[model samples]
Target: MKPVSLYNDIASTSYPGRGIVIGKSADGSKAVIAYFIMGRSENSRNRVFAETEDGIKTQAFDPSKLVDPSLIIYSPVRVLGNKTIVTNGDQTDTVYDLMNEGQTFEQSLTTREFEPDGPNYTPRISGIVECENGNMNYAMSILKSADGNPDCCERYTFTYDKPINGLGRFIHTYMSDGNPLPSFEGEPTLVEIGNDDIDTFAEKIWNSLNEDNKVSLFVRYIDIASNKAESRIINKNK
Candidate 1:
């Protein structure tokens, strides 16, 4: 395997769009997970992360200003037994349901594709971190349009068993800001996960995002041995 570039500062990039990061913390004791959303439109920006019984969901910061809830609002994270599922779209539920039926993560995502929103045709990115037998492993998937063609869908899945400490993989909806947003290309980028402090890490990520476009962020660090988790949430709207 080629040496992966370590992205330590996310703010270096103006826009990475919705992203997911999964890896092990520097301490080598916790499984780290992070998901964040950024938007250029008012509809996408008017949102906040609300904690749910199992995970987190996006809600309109001002319900009255919400124009379309179809694609902007959905549960971004959920927990099913020893597995935690996160996604950039409603596929979170699809993966959850499939897992409940005893199906694998990749199999569940095979039935879904990129977002219907055209021109951009935003890619659907999803991940799952499973903790069991005193160990943790993760998988990430991205479903995108084939060369901007709405009719063709391209799917990619990456799995990591026993991820290296202080390292994570990041996959987002877009490669960068564009007139018609371009889909994220190639494999997920490798990133460094500093210390085990959830607050500092979460704040670093939130602050790194383009201030004007950033909306909300959620970070979780799960102890592999005890199955315990600590989380931090930051919402610009709040």
Candidate 2:
């Protein structure tokens, strides 16, 4: 599929819910990863991406204002060896734990499904980037309801081996805002991953997102040869 402009795709939607992007930098020197959260409710918006030892976790910007933590709070990004795992919910732990037990990324996700939120059944979008021997590969998955039917779950995993420079895949929880938010359909959108440093890349994504719905964003660039990473976090609350 032809790559579409990342900024335009994100700016076109008022609420994409949560999203994950994995790609290679234009210079082909760094492995790029981006994850962002957007919300329509108070509980969802009252969040900030806090840096953890391995990755980043969602925490309430205002502790007292947090109404429900069940679905709102989660470690969206985690690191395991040379692999980086990112997801929309607690499934991050599921992938991390299962993978620790020698399970593949796709295998680890088999034990989980879409969120329980009715009508919407928000899809659990996930991504993993692995780097070794100066080579990088990644995969993205979406565990969603079968056409909004809770009785069935549909899973899709897209793998990229030696990804092309300046290109990436974009996946999110919703297609757009609605009475009952619609789950994202089809494969992840092919997006342009321009040559930008961590800060510039983060700014581009943060600025493209809907101002009122976007909560927090995290962007990281990992050097394929050294396995070193540089990251940036942007939170609307602060």
Candidate 3:
């Protein structure tokens, strides 16, 4: 059996609103992006990812108490295939639509609002495809939260060769949005197990996480030459 390693397992609960994990999948052909918008409020508790003509759309499943949701959970672009984009709140479809119409990356994000979690602006994480050749690049920004009333924000980007065999720099900031920016500092961890070991590893990781915090876990592999990729998302609550 091929030896597998731990990549990153960044766990965060800072936003009373949502949690997003974006990175490269093991075997590294496709990008891995998981978003879980959670809250005690009824609107926040509902899920919001749906397929759209251009790409994907997010709408309050309940649509009752959700306020200004358009700016809160939208992604202005989507990078799929060789490019894929995922955001927790909105703008997801907008991004997809623009990209489908041939808009440039930055062009797609031009009108979207910063994240709502500020000091980090609602935190937005993205996994951008670097080339038609299938390489991965990523970026995320957080605007200041309401507590700061404004005047605080943070932006970070990690774009490089894919590292599926080991760990890379994992963000460490907490849900509090404070400095000393928290991170999973140990050598990066990789999660590339053999097909045979996936079940066991999945069980271990799934059983170990808290019920509410446990979101979806996806793994993918690709043959660079063929440009074909295989992937899946393990939604524990499903």
Predicted structure with the largest TM-score when compared to the true one: 2
What are the per-residue Cα lDDT tens digits for candidate 2 across 97-194?
A: 99999999999999999999998999999999999999999999999998889999999999999999999999999999997989999989999998
Candidate 1: where are CA atoms >4 Å away? 1-9
What TM-score does structure 1 among the candidates reach? 0.96
- TM-scores of the candidates are 0.96, 0.99, 0.56
Candidate order by decreasing lDDT: 2, 1, 3
Q: Work out how many backbone clashes candidate 1 has.
A: 0
Tell me how far the alpha carbon of residue 117 in candidate 2 is from the true structure, in angstroms, after superposition: 0.7
RMSD of 2: 0.7
True lDDT of residue 93, candidate 2: 99
- TM-score (C-alpha) between model 2 and the true structure: 0.99
Best by lDDT: 2
Which lDDT values do the candidates have, in the order given?
0.89, 0.94, 0.42
Model 2 clashing residue pairs (backbone) = none
Q: Predictions ranked by TM-score, top down?
A: 2, 1, 3
Q: lDDT per residue, candidate 3, 1-238, as tens digits?
A: 2323322233323322343344454445444443443343344444355544324444555566666564544542344556656554455665567877898545565555445443434444443444355454555433223343445333334444654522222222234323422322222123343332334544544444345644333333333445454443345333
